[model samples]
Target: MSKTDVSKKALLSVNDLCMYFDSAGRRIKAAEHVSFEINEGEVFGLVGESGSGKSSIGKCIIGLNRATSGSISFHGTELTGIKSRREYTEKMRDIQMIFQDPMSSLNPKKQVGQIIRDALKIQHIGKDAKERDKMAADAFRRVGIPVEYADRYPRSFSGGQRQRIGIARALAGKPKLVIADECIAALDASVQAQIVNMINEIKKETGTAFLFISHDLSMVRFLSDRIGVLHLGYLLETGTAEEIFREPMHPYTRKLLGAIPRCQCRILLRAANHSVRLSATTLR
Candidate 1:
């Protein structure tokens, strides 16, 4: 039996979600019967290989892609039942997403500050323009970006900086749940560590729930409170991060853990044994 926590009030619940794509009369099952819940102030990590329907689930939750079957509920409200524009907008304000690619997600033409301000305005967050501007700068500062960098365009920033900017924009709306889809995948090793630290800090400070989707098992194990393992469009296992890593129930889950390099696996086991977070030093 899956060991996902059922004690807390679910912030976001997905039930039997199936996403299929039609191409040349053939049906592609992107996600099949995926079910999980993310509680308030919790991080639920989804781990899978490429083409394993991880991103597809994120997109479905954020309304980017409509699922073929099943239901999605946020705070007891069914997503598909929300038809009114006002209601949809209000709901979206409570849920946000950070995409995999920072450069592709951001507008190269707009200043970094403007990007954040736009989100604040769209969410109807601040009282006025000046307040919105201040919020944008604050968002930048929260993400460890200098306020001065706000004037620069996305093209001027490094990949890590751009990703931070994307995170700033996502948090500007003050969303309750953030779906971070492979958020650190595009960055270099050092930058990835920085981003991971930032994410953990942000989650602690803001009390926001996260659906952190990634292929990196080590990173997922470090970051997630609970974890779901996916393979071939199916959810194979669900458990606490410690449970999943130490005593993986599914064969696929074991296969994934076994694929880790021997040196890294040693570090992972050491960290797990000590009940410590995987540090940047050990990750290298």
Candidate 2:
């Protein structure tokens, strides 16, 4: 199904998700009462300034850090305080994460093919060794990586290529939801656009839901079906990408838009218009 025709079936849901940390005997609130829902086969963009806890929320979803208090569910299974390993693993198999730093996210010692294939092996995607190899090569090919490069090390690849590998690793699981945390931030603008386009194509082919976390509003606008604006660890506003870009309700959102004075109006207009053909569903 296309994004515009996405069903209202909630693939992931978060309510009152609070992630706090104690630093030097002081409570640091990273995310408080942040809530949003990602519909089936839709892109739910989360945007914020640096330290706005955009990645923190993504981490919460992937279980890198536990929620201090809140609810996170995947396909109706509650993830908060989850005690069953098998349950979490099963749900996680339907979920995968692509970290921002491709170089760091991958294992330095493992070959690129091994890295991608490991995801399938862990999930047992293939019934036999030959099938698994074919699946791994297919993933590499889909991500624009040559199957021959599978045995190469990540350190030998360029930044953009490494990012592609990271994406391939994430998709190897054939997950229902993929949390991409600033997956293109480190690359140049041109490469960034390429990755975004690649992601869009993959989404269309796979019908996967994306919780796309990024600091760049333009990028978010280009990919998101719905958007939630975060500030100082609090979700200030949420609306259709067009609504938020064309007319920002919160002062923070406006401030963020206005920060790019040179291309302020241009960015907002393009982003707003980009959403014209996108789905209308937004988090309430």
Candidate 3:
């Protein structure tokens, strides 16, 4: 597809999407007037602190949580109030989710092979058990998981391995868009880089769009083509990663950047604080 074709073809379109909950006598707005478009083959980063409604937006897009108002259209179809199982399944196939924790996402009782095959079985993609098994093994290999490990339980593997299994499962159906909610947060720093690189590679190879939600600004900058900042359930800013990073316009965006640790500056800040405290004690 040409650049214009890819830009115009949004895998997911969300407009004015709002989600609220009744907590005691007060109302909590988890997502307020959130609007964005995720184009084909683009990785969009949703950066926010906890309670900023980043994950809530992902849940609403995937149909795990209901929206109170606004619209979510996947491709050209509206997804609100989709109750039919067939319709839901079709929508889900187009948009898959990779959650933060891989261990919890997989079934403890089911073998790794069975878990990967479940989506294909449910979608009735393969004609027979042999075809399904072959497809599952291929998916596992694509995500860097050894085919032999498919028979083992999730507990048998390390965090990175389990995450690869999760990615394999998510791609088994060849979804157009994947919502990765803090998907790399649980892994070690080194493993996090590997997983992020793997995700970028897959996106480039398959032309899959990704909505990567995380609080890690640096990582998001590395992975995202575009970035959206959220604060207190509202979207503060949206722009290309370079624009947002080099010339942040929103106050919240500035604060979020300030919170990130700079090696030399952070040490200097700590030393200055310590000196100020000592001075105060002497004066008192």
Ranking under lDDT, best-scoring first?
1, 3, 2
Give the TM-scores of the predictions, in the order they appear. Answer: 0.89, 0.88, 0.90
Candidate 1 scores a C-alpha RMSD against the true structure in Å of: 6.4
Residue 90, candidate 3: Cα error in Å is 1.8
Angstrom error at residue 95, model 2: 0.8
The parts of candidate 2 lying over 4 Å away from their true place are 1-7, 261-284
Model 1: per-residue lDDT, tens digit, 116-211?
888888778899999999888888989999999888889898999999999998888778999999999999989999998898998999999999
Q: lDDT per residue, candidate 2, 1-284, as tens digits? A: 23553547888989999999888999988999998888888899999877778888899999988899999999898988877877677768888998898769889999999987777887777787788788888889999998989999989998899999998888876889999999999999899999999999988998998999998878888998889999879999988788888999997787666544244778767656544422232211
User: lDDT per residue, candidate 3, 93-212, as tens digits?
Assistant: 778889898769888888999997887889777788899899899889888888988889988988898888888888887889999999998999999999999999999999999999
Model 2, position 77, has a per-residue lDDT of 88
lDDT for position 165 in model 3: 87
Error of 3 at 184 (Å): 0.8
Please report, in order, the local distance difference test score of every candidate based on alpha carbons.
Answer: 0.87, 0.85, 0.86
Please give the TM-score that candidate 3 achieves against the real structure.
0.90
Which consecutive 10 residues in model 1 have the weakest lDDT in total?
A: 274-283
Best by TM-score: 3
Q: Whole-model lDDT, candidate 3?
A: 0.86
Deviating ranges (above 4 Å) for candidate 3: 1-7, 265-284
